[model samples]
Target: MAHFNKAFQFKTRSIIVLLTVFGFQLTAQNWDVPADKKAKNSYIKFDKTTASEGEGIYTKNCASCHGNPSKGNVLKSLKPTPPDLASSGTQKLTDGELFYILNTGRGLMPSFKDVLSESDRWKVIAYVRSFNKSYVQVLSNTDPTKSDKVKVTMVYNHETNTVRVQVVAKEQNTSLPLKDAEVLLFAKRYFGKLPIEKGLKTDESGVANFVYPKDLPGNKLGEVELLVKVNDEVYGEVESSTKLKIGIPTDKPGLTQQRAIWGVLAKAPYWIIALYLLGIATFGVFVLYLVKNLFDFWKKGQQ
Candidate 1:
């Protein structure tokens, strides 16, 4: 009886531990978004027009998993699965809080600070909040705090085959340079932007240098768009872009790409080609035989 009691106690403890872990996982997702000290209420008013504009941004950047507005369906294969932004799980977050999340993504979500321009991200927030109709008027009435935006210039050096980046943060009201800001560089690819080099902090002169690939793969035209961005830990994000000429696209298929299952007809196995030819020949013969039989029947009727 004692041995059975000991086993029962062990099983009970195991079940309790499992339940605790499961409960924690469920609870954590609710408050998983980190606080953004820079986050503040949006000044931009929410309206059907603003939300419609935001819908364009959201569909392109967010709809893959969250749910496509066009299709009205979402991908559910992810482990935790992306939440429906229109639902209470996301609608409950304030406009500022939602903006912060878009700026700084958590877990499987990606930060759109660099992917999207500052105004576009705000536009997306407007579209998302439109799902709840209560805050439309309140958002328009609230005053917004203005923050300093950054300006970045990129010059590609042909002699050294490197990119020279200059980042200057200045208040929109005052054009004077703000020093010691962090800047990031990104090269646009077919699917998305690929970040190159570590984030650099500007010097006293507000200049930072980076080495970009001299032969980065690109489209058939060999053009790669380079982006320089700065996301302030305290303020808003700003960015600039310049197109650079890179190496030609590497999409030209090799000889190895010419064979097997999905290969061109010329690259197909001789036997398969022969079978294809035989099928055509057999079809031709079948038609000819039927024609011959019909002619013979006509002749016999005439006789």
Candidate 2:
């Protein structure tokens, strides 16, 4: 019947409008990449070493306020709850977009441009990605707990010509004394290519003693430079000079010896010697002139 057809048409039209509105809403909402796409390129090739470094950076610079992202310590009162980085929200964002946010900052978050290098920011991005279960699963597949440790420090002694250098292995809050660990020491000329001596281990107090030979050539009477290495893993360097002087007696000689040498050299008066030489020259010249005049007179008389 005509009425039935009208109802059917209305229903169909209503359904079509609803479908169109839903499509628009879905398009407006930003969704993450499809599961199939993620599966195809699940692994984001990044430097594992760099991510490990970013872990430390996160601990030092970001841990104070953010705590651990895994623990959900997000600041909710802020405009938008720090987007759950572990959730699809982060995955939906492209790497470049995420990088921009991290470098430029958003809301209360400070810009990391001045704080982190470009490579470092990428490392951090990799670390943030790791929060996602998919990425976490990938990381675990590679090796869940790979060792990622590094050391950065230099130590040495100048006076004793000894040194102990090693990488420090303590968190920012912790303090490690040089006495607690064993330090290694290596010896060589400051700028020498080859190491003059092999490596030596440190004592309980992390001290390494280096005694230079008294008769070592080139160093006997001048400054000796030595390169110190600790644990065979770090370099501790110091420039030390030997205390040796030749022809210079340690004890002062008696004044008599000095005066005797001076007396001998001063015995002949310089003024008297000069006057005697002048008188001899004058007498010789006078005798020569008289002989010449007598010879001239004899020649004239003979003529």
Candidate 3:
């Protein structure tokens, strides 16, 4: 009886631990996307050509973690093993859901929203869907050509230290305001674009306002290039760039202006240049002296 009771207790503990771990895994994998994002569809059609292009893109960007589709060679070292794209579980997810996951990554997954264009992201989805033989794509009703009709203008407010972005779509003879659209503003920098603030949604009047930083540095002329990206369900994605004279005027000296070891030869320190030339001259003189000595020794041998 004692042995039976001990075995029962051990089994209970084991079951409880397994349940706890399984519950945690379920919670981690649950990506609760909004209703709008879940319903969003791709403007690009899924075809063989686009799927082939997407395969190349996936090999470069996603294969490192997810591995090739249908292959069980995923990197299992990760805490939550990435699912194979060809697996039934992955194929069950809606196209919009897959897009949302790519845009808003969790844990070890990095967001590709900034890295890949909207067209490219859709192409990647097309490639993944290719693995599902029975999968049928539902194209978005949004007209991608309307993206060219979109116009975005940004204006800075001096007193409030804010930038106002207005979006409008022109069709026929009427200009319609684009309301409730997603807008992202960025400032161009030497290395990469810097986000001005958190992404904002346009209001009823098709305007989104962002607070600009007062301490942000600009060129000597205080000119900063601003880029705005607008995403609307009806118009797809549109981007516009403009230069503004709002940042702090910075006139920092160029890196190559001052003498540095990493600088160009012309920008190298005078002492370093002098030393290099002196070393070359000294080597030439030693070679000439050795040649003269050899010549004198030959003359003595002849004598």
Candidate 4:
């Protein structure tokens, strides 16, 4: 009787522990999303438009591999079955993880880095989560409606050695400044790694400024390909073929002048002119020495 009671107590404790763990996992999964489920009085709004847009995007782009979301045909063919979007697996993933998978692609899924814009990718992810309760819960937790509408502008100036970046939030038909939006600027060079620069948020006008180094070692100032991102979403990118002319340092004016003079001299017959002057100077010195020797011999004979 005692042994049976001990075994029963052990089993009960084990069951409790398992239940607690499962509950924790569920809560954790739920917490990974933004906290706006009903779209009522929310900062970020989601509706049929976004979901339809996402469905269209997915059909055009993702359906080739993932298959029809409703049927899960293509997904089933894989060795390990792809998680059904309409099932519990969809809710099991965090919004960030889903975004990462959609954008970066894992295993057989191809990366959509070039194919989809960051915002569109997020929208599709939001749509995929709408299929099930778990996904809906996750989306509700990771609300896209909370995103501040931001406008981004990129300006590259070769003369000033600067890449001026601007970001603004659009609210109520008026543009308000977004302060402290992290800006990442990168310029790809021909021969080496891209130079990266980071800038802080704007003041009243929502502008961030990053100056390109006056002299990027081993890189000529020429057309540089640039990539810019704000809040992890790509803002805008531009490839400028602007040339950055080499500037002489203030302390090296003499060297600059010497270089200028030598450049002009190089264009002319400098070697021939130098040789001719050297020959004339040699002849003049020889003639003076010979005349002095002759005068000295005459004086000695007189003595």
The number of the candidate with the highest TM-score is: 3
Estimate the TM-score for candidate 4: 0.43
Q: After superposition, how far is residue 272 of candidate 1 from its true place, in Å?
A: 44
Local distance difference test, each candidate: 0.71, 0.50, 0.91, 0.58
RMSD of 2: 31.4
Q: Could you give candidate 4's per-residue lDDT for residues 1-303 as a string of tens digits?
A: 999999999999999999998766444232233332122121122357777788889889877766767576665565444555655666556666565566556556678877988668766765776675533432223224434465667776667867777777667798766565556666544344464664455555667777777655322333345656665122222222223332222342333244333446554356666886899999999999999999999999999
Q: Compute each candidate's TM-score over C-alphas.
A: 0.45, 0.29, 0.60, 0.43
Give candidate 2's error at residue 278 in angstroms: 78
User: What's the CA RMSD of model 1 in angstroms?
Assistant: 9.4
Q: Cα lDDT for residue 123, model 1?
A: 85
Question: Taking the tens digit of each residue's C-alpha lDDT, what string does model 2 give over 249-297?
Answer: 2234433444443344445356665676899999999999999999999
Name the regions of candidate 1 deviating beyond 4 angstroms. 26-28, 32-39, 68-72, 137-303
Models ranked on lDDT: 3, 1, 4, 2
lDDT per residue for candidate 1 within 78-114, as digits (tens), equals 6466777877767777766777778787767788888
Clashing pairs in 4: 33-141, 33-142, 34-140, 34-141, 34-142, 34-143, 44-145, 180-201
10 residues in a row with least lDDT, candidate 3: 22-31
Q: Relative to the unseen true structure, what is the C-alpha lDDT of residue 164 in candidate 1, on a scale of 0 to 100?
A: 77
* Highest lDDT against the true fold, candidate: 3
